[model samples]
Target: MNRNAMTYRLFPAVFLLASAVATAAGTATVTQPEKLREQPGSSSWSIMELHRRTTVRVLETRRDWVQVEADGNRRGWVREQSLSMDAPTQNAFASPTRQPVGTDLPPVPRTAPRASNHALLLSLGSAAPASRQDATHAAAIARLMGVPDANIRQPAQAELTLDGLRKALVDLDARMGDRDRAFIHVSGNSTRLREAGRCSTGFTLPTSKDVLTATELAAHVRSLAHRADKLVLLIDTRAGAGACQASEDTVTHSLNEGKSRNILYLGATQEASTTPANSQGGLFTQALLACLDGRATLSAAAGMPTGRELVDCTRTTLANHPGARPLVTLAGNGNLIPAPVMPRGDAISPHALLTALHAQRDERRQISVNGLRTNYRAGGKPMRFTLTSSQPGYLHVVAASNDGFTLLYPNQIDPLGRIERTLTVTLPAQDNQTRPAPRASQSKATLLFLVTDGPRNFFRAGLSRAGAFAAAPADARTLRDLPLEILGGDNSPTCTRSETRNLGPSQLLLCSTSFGSALQEITETP
Candidate 1:
């Protein structure tokens, strides 16, 4: 063959060799890992760090960062530079047809499980109003557990006759699969001892009428302790004479002997009795509801560092009755001081209280997923929802539940759409023994977004469908086709507006103009 022909044949072999070398060098692809950022120069703060590698599946990506799950099933964030687009494989240049890599990538993280649906027994003491408070608190707890609003039983009145209490328990048992624990509310004088069809002081010395006698209430509590998985007892009363002493003794005895998985007892006493104040009970109720909604441990919610508040409150209330333990007043430790009597019926508005409770409940539920972070993307569009606050100055987002109801939060959204910084939520498991056939219900989940310009805000039409535009001054008429709900107005005299629309079977869009223009969409599961 001629020299030129020979050279051409050799050139093909040389080119093939070069191509092989390039392929072996390994391709470098840009990947954005999930990360958590902290402020600079703070003892409690830490800077940006890689949480996971790019080879893992990217659940979602935004402008600044991406969320990924690692091979070991951990999820977190890393800077965009920390990730590379290298295809995960056992051998760098292995043939595509060959087994790609180490045991198939780990399973995706599952959303937190729903709380158990079971009957929640609530016991009320002498105060009829306290019953209502307990019911409200129970509703808040239910929300925290991801229980649908339709599943919660909020009695019309607090005071249930003995028959009513029994019937309520039975009905709740049927609805809740009979495995739920009971909540006992002991407050006020309505529970005073009764004789000859009239209210009167009982013979029991140094004990309050609101609480159970050491013998009677103890037996009932013990029975419940054995039958239920958890028991929450609350004592809301003034430390005074009569049945207060017995009530304390009964509760203390039960706590010492109870074997329930979780037991929470709270007590508050009046510092001084002047005219009855409604705010006192309301405040305690508010705090309790907040705690329950926040899903805070009992100790944190009661502000009881040593778990001795209940013991002390019981001791003081009982000491006033004859034949009771001596009132043991300990030195102050700079804890909360008892407040003087509040004005009678100086209670918070029910609407305001419900709104607040809903906000907290929403917040608690939003943080259910663990080990994730969030960042916004530049090109992504905004989603909007209405923002309403019973109390002004509170801006928050609401999340949907598995059952399709909106859960509101009291604060801003976290990196992973969680309401707060914390992760890990505890939920009660289904009690199969009592509920063989769980109730059949439809899922109608929606998220309610609330932005605040003042203490009390409304979901105005102008703010609707505001998610389509990022904080720009675009005319509303320009974006009429999108699903939006106008809320309030901009800093200018222009009317503020928010937008709301359904995203999918499990998601809702909420947009706001309050904090430098933001759009948030919350998703629910059924």
Candidate 2:
């Protein structure tokens, strides 16, 4: 609640400079895009981003953070380098009391004012059973943004319909009248907005017609979007195939009237993306949540995912599911999601986090989640095995099929514990598709491990000891739907040092390390 338009957009930019250069400089012009942050550090969240060549009058300065004013409310801190110190020469002699001949007033700084000061997003999930997964994902995203759990809307009501959805949106609109930078994620319907093809698979599967017809829903969304500075409408359902390919037309129509603000529209499939009522989440929603989970390398940094990267991550992660095609539409260049903020009283600072990250990378290299070759199994047995580790670390194991991820180690029998040297565990038997089983002679799985360096329970978010992941409808699942934060967080016990060599890919590397999924394998014992 003590949040401000904050970010250390200056952190990386200012890290290289000395204190002397941080003095209050003269008015300047922005030579490149500049992100205004609320605080003076690199890890702070960005409040507003100004484009290249924009001009501003310098107001004050702090270490590498320069406070500038382009207008009344457009005042914030940005890194000094983002602006050109050589502001357009202004006549020093010119004064309001007496102007010199041919005196030229400084041209108005080329700045586009923001629509609002703050943003309040609501992730509305369909109360229907089939749509619960979609709502679950929306809630996860809201959680990622550090949005309070109370503000996030879920399908808790006995009956869910279109009218209820509209009323909710209407109430939220009234509550958020022209607030700045408000971001919202509504997960209910899917559409390729251009063709007006909408499907409420998650909603209808529960055996109720959407209170609002497709047209009415679109109209309602447009009306609500009319007030926001940025809107990210996540469609959990996918529209039926109808000559219209999975495309970025979803928000084009709804947000056209309010195009001045930024909007990032995403849906699972232009063609109906499916989720069995029992699946962990809708096909597209699963990938979306994973990308936002701070693990996906959509960008060099894990601050948050951008609109463009969201499409790329979802497309590739969901590729194996040929039927579910996720699409994206970008209305403007802006980051709608706020970077994850650590809980207060947490000692982990931005500098400390950056240091920890570098240390973790080095540790990842030295350690190994080696699938040890046992004396009993000459070639290699996927079923009978002993999984060894080079050092003490937190490990999660999963097996992947073209179908989806099946949790292995963090199961009921072999829970996620601090392993010092090695762990003796078994892979699922062949033909047992649920756990890590060998398909080819060597099935692939990943050893998703992190060195505690003696630091444990990073997020302190407890790990799941359940025997299995939440069941997915035999179809439409993507990756394991478990508590991924078990991996770690800002305040999680930190890694002390890096090891010598990193573990390489295994013959049975099933999980995609690139996508941030988890898995660890052990050679089956004889």
Candidate 3:
């Protein structure tokens, strides 16, 4: 056909396309097993099967079929009868625990014993030349990982040569096991570590020696494998194409060699990258510090962070880098408590405590975790919070229970980080289901709320990879699965259990900073 003739022939289809673009768009759920036919009619060849409840965007409509796109791709026609355009009020896919609106949601403490619990904190690194900050950063991380200052082997800050790295690794291996002994109980580890007492000189090696070679790192792994019940190795170093050996390869090999699956592995970077540097320390190391200290604003029912939680939470916040996802290797149950939630700053702030009460023109009654014990019987009414703020900002909630402290609000949903003047949240009481052991005595826990001018971007950014987590309300199961501690301690009888030990007043630590926080002490009696 002539060019003029072809132009006229295409006008009708072009007009239809323009019309579809000018209108509003909505999502349609596929009602049944149907074909994404090339054309709207049944005679057209089928492209693929469309399953039920699949959200498809509506584009244009014909007499009996509608053209839609599934998951932003694969355009085709679905019978008009097979598409539901109405908004779904409940979950697109049914969940087992689906109940009422608020009841279904709002689901969901402690320190570890000092002597028994132990960790082998090292700056998993290369024979790369060192900086003063490097040595200080390694020691700082060891402390955050709950390694007693006495047990840490300080590497020379000026130049960490290969031989020095080897000696440190060898000394670490010695402390973890004797000539005949491979594994030790927490009680034994406590004694051995205390006796060792900063035995590592933290000296730099001469320039000639090479360290962190794959073979040597592997040897260190072999010796220490299955050496402790609860072990955490924080690798804040380079992970090149194969340099920073991840938990994947090392952990699996250890398990095969009769090592405990109880180990939780965390690395700062992957593949030819250095742990990004920040003012306080390496960016990733700082994230780990924030998570361990409870400043990351993540909480679990289990009192403190689980191995998975620690890795996941810390990696999540470090997502600002282009290739910033850190490696988190969880073996077996993967619920190792790396540290306790020790909130820094005074838990009680006059401005934060009074903001809610003053909004009602009532006398501001201040309370703190140590202020007063509000007691209630187990299985009674759930503890409720009526939080308010005169100023506009985001609201953060964390509680210290029999398990450890963790973040409560802003779990995937509420991304805006906005809060109302007043809102009510009902927390499940001390039930046998989540809280630790015999609900026979009065149990006490504390809740801390932080009010910030804008979003706790770190918290939200860290949890971004957990798709839909931001949209759903916090629940018991979610708490348990959280790579960190969500539910309080599972309390299973094992040398190394799911959660960490209880926190004492001595363990209360701080994060980098907080805008303002309010603390509440809740006492639940049997």
Candidate 4:
């Protein structure tokens, strides 16, 4: 018969529970003999019997089978009658706390100090040609983040059975030692990506039909959140336009409510092909890999140049996307702290980075707040402002500060910190400036201009030198009609104009001019 048929045939007989009987002495013997199947008596086949009693732990019973855990903590199902549950066996199995069975086994304790206190769960993508790069990057990130590969629970590809996934999770749990931190990496392949998403819901593969669904993923993740001190989910995709968005949505929608506090999502944007060829991987992915490798930090790769800069690298990454824009949204009940500001002109040492992170926690004792804000510009206009306050959540600050623009939260400090509101000050116009006549030589040239109002320091100006000024008409409404000319007999383009304004030093406002051909030149007075 086929393997499926054989597996089906074995299922019914395997789950039949054995009757439990107690002796007068309150002790019981397992009368049933554990059955070990032998290959059909073929000339080349040999029966390998495993009779060792002391090396395994019978953790749980399912129908007639028991989940047997080996000394190495490898768990698998065994026939209910595989062994005699005599008084000695019963005593041995009764207390996992007691000495484990099996004298032939290595004398070294099977239970390592690190294994007892923590557990891990891992899910790998199901796609072929697994993204080894992502796996390697993830492992590195985990290490820097304080998780070692030895503690990681990698999925076994050879074992296509659902039992494989379960065994992996169990093994990971057994190996974690004392850190109850769970790190899950979702590499390429949509199916495995989907599976990882589902695992977060609580359903295990090989599970009955009753347990398979997206809801199970969220449930599992939620359950894991409660069981583990920290749970991190990392996804590495092709960064193809909507890939990151789709994956992020899947994660958000599948995760159980209130469990998001324990989760973190990282995605890379696809790179442009036209740009100078750098590497085979996506730019963002490469940056992330560098971060994992301990060669870079999110801030550094995002252009802050150093990790000490407490800037939101996400925005920078998005800004760098070739043809598309990237946006990162943090939603959940947990506090979002602004990473510490990187010291100016200093490379971020690991010690300094950690110290900054720790400082946020320390400051939290003094304040409590939570806030959320979205920062985006459309048509050079800024709009849409929303804030939610929590006594002990996050102090969301959205601004273009000198410290390289960022939206920060006091995560290391109190969650209930309040961010100052943005102040908008309109500059008064300068009426004393006279418009210069259009220069005859300014036409047919790309205009480089700067426009700002005069007195209050807000004015607009334009310039061109390739042709006569008549070629470029200026509209008073849009400043397109501004005169363009070369001043002081210089072959290079120049413009001069003077404007008077009444404003106090306290009211002065400084803003960078928009960089473009239009801002190339401004006619001004000597």
Candidate 5:
């Protein structure tokens, strides 16, 4: 056909296409299994899977693909051919005519192939010299994670003014990618006010005329959360009794409520509680630094601590301070490693080691191991514990300490680990002819027990003849599978035991997978 004839022939189809694009609103149901991709092309990375019948809000159309906002506010693109324009009759997707109301949606953020980790370590220290100290320690922690110094922003105390704070936040946002990890630590003095049954908190910096309110600060940090895979916020604000006496919402609540699930907040104190005065630094910051640096131990996997570890350690560190309550709100998985503190002789990243361990644990089957006491005086009596199981199985116990792993049970003196439904064992068996002295100094130990349907020999080659203890390998793979293993040495990351601290005398140290595992902590004092 000639040009004039072809133009007339395409006019109708073009008109229809314009009409469809202009009025493309409301929701659509997935016709089949589809990929929610990062971009409109099929070659784009899949953000998530859109199962059959999943209904999503249709934001806009791009030729063969359509942009959608799915559950959890996840925005991505799905093939138009995979979607049914008909919206669901019920649930959150019921309103086909309803369009998103309120602020204009920001462009979908893009994540790099290998995301980088960033930190904003603001001193905010005007009067409190300790705030500056906290910043230094936090920077050290960030360095361990391999975050470059340029990625760690430490604004001067004088630059903490209202305008300066905004500029700093903007600068940080510019540096962050969608998949980046963010660590934000703010240390300063704070004030809380209660009026008309509402509580408000503000950071009071001597250098700034205006106090930085929690609400204002959260607004800026909230944006960062949307751009990062994980954002850990550490607030070490020292508040007076007058600011903490009121019974109401806390500064933490204001900072994280209805925010992104990627955010993990660790505040110094809760509402109606004041941070104890610490000459070293903010009490929470001090404990955090200790946990990150291995000086203080709460819980660890492959020699690296998780977010829960930091929280548990902080709670313990502040337990003695009257009216001091450390506040923690974990919007993300607390089990995930917050800091990648690569300790000496450790070749594995904390996340990889934990992931490997988790794959070995079995959650369906459970075993409980109990100790006589969680605490013991140094140079006191030898430790003893009982293992209980519904099913008879072989037992393997390993002790973890600062010195490393030692196979406590199945040793030279008592070789057999065969157990019935219940068994009680002593550290230095009475059957032993030579008596070993008690622990000379104060230290903490985690006794991990793995009971399997069949016998599993882990670290058998490393066991010593005299003490009946085996030294574990320093490699990551051995450390990962050592927790739980069955006969024949299969890869079992199913029963990766999690570590927790108990307020009482007896604490549940670790619980593993289907292999039936348990762990208990023991404190030896001098």
Candidate 6:
């Protein structure tokens, strides 16, 4: 054979070898908690749940899914988007020292310092009243999280042109030191475009082009990540088709390839979706702020809310609003405190209070409240619900709201909360269970059903009103006490041998005799 013909054959073999090597070169870190499915599609049974920052070996890929081998040799398929590849050159932007047009760069710190929290907020739709409100609320949250006033910045919406955005990022990048924590929140409009067979999204600014591409934004984020111990990026905008997916990929790659191992990317909507608005503002923002509001009340004893708590609370608050499914990527162990824990206050949001209760909930004894309507209209049919316990126990049902807490069960008409394993109790005694129409302001509430080994009174002695089903007021402090009060408080007659588990900053308690608790969220319609 001629020399050229032999060389051609060798080239093909070399190409195949290089391709295989490339496929096997790197590992992936879970950015989102996802189940490793026995098969690629969503319907397949899950082998196990892969949590954030769990490293896995990628064995092969199939379009949107990748087969991976996790710890203990457990292998299964997960969505490609749920994992971030370890790619060194995947960052979208240039070095932090590189100044963009119309920005003055500050002196970059040369050495690592003790990590501190910093924040930068931008509101692109300054002309809109709602956007302005969101921006103001976001700034308050940053401060509550312990970001110093000097370390936080919020550029005027009118000045947030493409150049203005770059200038702000450059300034934040310069202010950040190695091992510091940074938070960047952008509340604005968004534009999506497809060019050169690639889809990219951008924040619509006030400049001539009025759009800052996702690639550019991610690059700046990457630059900041290099100096940060942890970083959180919150994008609240009207996302178009491919908007969330493209930005998520870009930001995920930015963090994965950077020195920072702990990061969070929270987006307001899914691909091609728009978040719904409420009197407070966008539902997503309202949910987020509500969660933040509870930080002081709901956070662990030592400090602020963890990344996991915020993600969980935000998800729970927005669960009822299908149009606002947040795209969350929490990439770290659950120990990272996103903010400083605030002093306890009565202004605690219901969602935050729920988070604290949820942290202590254990369902081993199997108790539930059923037939409760998720949504009720004003002047609607009578509300009816049944409570069942797998083991014999005393039932205490408390309804929590922003206004206060109420002992909805065991009221005057019923008086008896004790139940048997073989029996089910229906509220209102089938006589006085009907409720007066709820007002517009009373649109939401959460019901906590606690089945304990012994009877417990959530309300004070002798504060009942005159009615068929007279109930006493239970304050926020009463509800916040939760399972601990149920298990270890002096009021529990038969409780004994209570133990506590310290998880990072939060300490949860367990009783020798297990109790069951369930929560139901109620929404009122007009």
**Which candidate achieves the best lDDT against the true structure?**
5
Q: Over the stretch 1-526, how does candidate 4's per-residue lDDT look in tens digits?
A: 2222322343333223213111111211122222222321123232222332222344555676555433222345555655444223111111123335542211111111121122232323333323333443344344434332234344534532345554654555444322144565544322222344332222223222222233444445565555443455544333222112243444556553454644544433232232332223223444443332322334432212222221244344335445434333333222322111121223433222222222222211233212212322212222222332221222323112111111122212222333333212211121223223434432211111111111111012222221111111222211211111100011111100100012232221111110111111112221
Q: Estimate each model's TM-score.
A: 0.29, 0.36, 0.35, 0.33, 0.43, 0.40
Residue-level lDDT tens digits of model 5 in 123-201: 7756554664566567656655535433566765567787887887888788764435678888777677653466777
Top candidate when judged by TM-score against the true structure: 5
The better candidate by lDDT, 3 or 4, is 3
Clashes of 4: 75
- lDDT scores of the candidates, listed in order: 0.31, 0.41, 0.42, 0.30, 0.57, 0.56
Number of colliding residue pairs in each model: 67, 40, 45, 75, 17, 3
Off by over 4 Å in 3: 1-138, 144-146, 157-163, 176-211, 225-227, 240-259, 273-281, 320-323, 331-333, 342-526
Local accuracy of candidate 2 as per-residue lDDT tens digits, 294-369? 3232442222235555667667666745455445444433333332322212222222222222221322224443
* Lowest-sum lDDT 10-residue window in model 5: 494-503
Quote the positional error of residue 66 for candidate 5 in Å. 58
Q: For candidate 6, which ten residues in a row score worst on lDDT?
A: 106-115
**In angstroms, how far off is 383's CA in candidate 1?**
52
Measured with C-alpha atoms, the lDDT of residue 29 in candidate 4 is 19
State the TM-score for model 2: 0.36
* Candidate 2 residue-wise lDDT at 175: 49
Candidate order by TM-score, decreasing, is 5, 6, 2, 3, 4, 1
Estimate, for each residue in 57-104, the C-alpha lDDT of model 1 and write its tens digit.
344445545444432233444344555644432211122343345533
The TM-score that candidate 1 achieves is 0.29
